[model samples]
Target: MAQIVGIGLLVLLLAFFTVFTYYAPHGDKAMGALAAAAIATFLVEALQSFVIGDIFSLGFFQEAGTEAGLLSGVIVAFLVALTMGVNPLNAAIIAVSCGGIGLIPGFFAAYLISFVVKYMERKIPNGLDFIVVVIVIVPITRLIGLLLTPLVDASLLNIGNIIVVATEASPILMGLLLGGIITVVGTSPLSSMALTALLGLTGIPMAVGSLAAFGSAFINSTLFHKLKIGNMKSVLSVAVEPLSKADVVSANPIPIYVTNFVGGGLSGIVIAYSGLVNDAPGTATPTAGLLVLFGYNPAAQVIIYAVIVAVISGVVGYIGSHFFRNYPVRNTDFD
Candidate 1:
C-alpha cells in the first residue's frame, strides 16, 4: 500500500508538472525554454557528476562545487522566467532569489514568484520598482521555497525508498508495474531520465525500467513501420524519442499506450527472470541499456537475449496496434 501510494504520488507530480509547464497556455514557448534550460543543466551536471567525477577520477570540481550551484541558479531562473513569461531582467532576479533549491521546489517557487510579480505589476505603484520587486519578491519566493523544500525533499525520498523496497520485496511484480509505467512516461513528452533520477531507482529495478522503455520503443517503431502508420524515418526515430512521431501517437494514443504496457510488461519479466542489473542512468533506450549489459554478461549472450526480447515485444506491440487500425490519422506538421 505504501509503495502504491509512493508511486502514485510520483506519477501525479510528473503528470501535473508536465501539464502545467508544457500543455497549458504559452506552453510552446515554455517547453522550448525548458528544453534549453534542460540542455544547459544536463551539460553542467554531466561535466561535474560524470566526466570529471567518474571518468577523470578527479576531486577538483567535486571539492569546489560552487560553480555547479551558481549554474543551477541561472538555469532555474531561466526556467522561471519562461514559465512566468517575463523578460530577462526579472528572470535573473527571481533566479538569484530562488537559488539553492531542488528542481521540484524551484518549479513551485518560480510559479509562485511569477504570480506575485504579475500581481504586483498590476497593483503596486511605479516608485522604487527595483527595490520593491527585487528585495521584496525575491525574499518572499525564496522563503516559500525554503519552507517547501524540506517537505518536498522528504516526500521524494520516501517515495524513492518505497520504490526501492517494493522492487526488492518482489522484483517480478514491481518490475512489471514500474516497467509498464516508466515506459509510458518515457514515450510521452516527459523525460525518462528525469523520472529515474527523481526516483533514484537503481540495480534490478532500474534495469527493468530501462529494459521496459527499450522494449516499448522497439515495439512502437517496428509496429509503426510494419503497419505503414508512419514514414520509415519517423518510425525509426520513435526508438530514440517517441515524440518525434507525436502525430501517430496522439492519433492512436490508446493503442500505443496499451501496446507499451504489454511490451514493457514482457520486457520486465525478462529482466526479472534473467536477474539483470543496470547501474547506469539513462538506460531508457535499447542501445544504451543493452550495451551496458556487456558489463555483467557475455557479449554474445546479451546480444541474443536482447534480440529475443525485442522480437517478442515487437510482436506483442504489433498485435496491440491492430486494435486502433481503423482510427484515422490526422495531419499535423512535424517540421
Candidate 2:
C-alpha cells in the first residue's frame, strides 16, 4: 500500500508539473524557467560528480556533497525567481534563504514559491507588495520546504525501489509495460530524463526504458521520411526530440503510439532476456544509451542488437502509420 501510494504520488506530481508548466496559460514562461533551473542544476551536479568528484576522490557532488550543494540550490532559486518576475536582489535573498535541497524537493519549493508570488503580485496593492513578499512569502515557502522535502524525498526513493522490485520480479512483463509507457511519456511534452532521474531508474530498467525511447525516435523519423509526411529536416529532428515536431506528432498520435509500443515492448523483451544493463541515465537521443550496454555485453553484440531493434521498429512504424490517412501533415518551418 505504501509503495502503491508513493508511486501514485510520483506519477501525479510528474503529470501535474508537466501540464502546469507546459500546457497551462502563460505556461511557456514557467516551462522556460523550469528548463533553465533543470539545466543549471543538473549540469552542475553531473559535472561535479563526473569531473570534480572523480579528481577529488571524495565524491564531492553525490547529492549531499558540501562544495556543490548550496550552489545548486541558489541557482534553482535564482532562475525560478527571475522567471517569476522578482528583482535580482530579492531573488538572491530568497535563494540563499532556501539553502540546498534535493532536486525534486527544490523544484516543488520553487514552483510553490513562484505560484504564490505570481498570485500575490496580482492580489496585493502596489504600495506595499514588495515588502509583503519579502517579509512573508520567503519564510512561508521555506517552511513549506521544511515540511515537504523529507516526505517527497523518501516517497520518491520508495517509488524507485518499488519499480525496481517489480521489474526484478517479472522482468519481461514489466519491461514491456514500463518501456512502452516511458517512451510515450518521453516523446510527449514530459521530460524523460526528469522522469527517469526522479524515479532513480538505473541498471536493466534504465536500459529497457532508454531503448523504448530510441525505438520511438527511430520509428517516427523513418516513417515520416518514407511517407514524405513532413519536411525532411523536421521529420529527422524527431530522432533527437519528438516534441520539436509537435504538429506532426499531434496529427498522427495513434500511429506514433502504436509504433512506439511495438518497438519499445520488443526492445524491453530483448533487454530482459539478454540481461543487458546500463548504469548511466539515458541521453536525449535514445540510441546514445545503447553504448552503455557495452559495459555489460560484448561491443559487437550490443551494436548488432541495436541495429536490429531500430530496423524492426522503423518498419513497424512505417507500416502502421499508413492506417491513419485522415491525419494529414501540416506545414511547418524548419527553423
TM per prediction: 0.69, 0.65
After superposing candidate 2, which stretches have Cα over 4 Å from the reference? 1-23, 39-77, 92-99, 102-105, 115-135, 146-162, 188-190, 219-238, 241-262, 281-288, 316-335
Candidate 1 yields a Cα-based lDDT of 0.62
Q: Write the per-residue lDDT of candidate 2 for residues 1-335, one digit (tens) a residue.
A: 54466447645654565456445544445444554554445434434442344334555354533344345556666666777676666566667657756544554566667766767767877656678877987787677667877786675565556556667678777676666656655554344544565665667787776666667777778767765667778677777656555434534455665566677777767766666665655332364455445555577777776776787677777776666545564443322
Question: Whole-model lDDT for model 2 versus the true structure?
Answer: 0.60
Clashing pairs in 1: none
C-alpha local distance difference test of each model? 0.62, 0.60
User: What is the RMSD of candidate 2?
Assistant: 5.8
- Model 1, 1-335: lDDT tens per residue? 77778767755754554455434655444444443443345334434543345434568754343255345434755575656665566767787776776554665576667766766666766545546778788888788778887887676675566656767788777767677766765554444544565565667777787667667777888667665666777777777655445334544455666678778877777777776766655445444455555655567766766776788787887787676677564422341
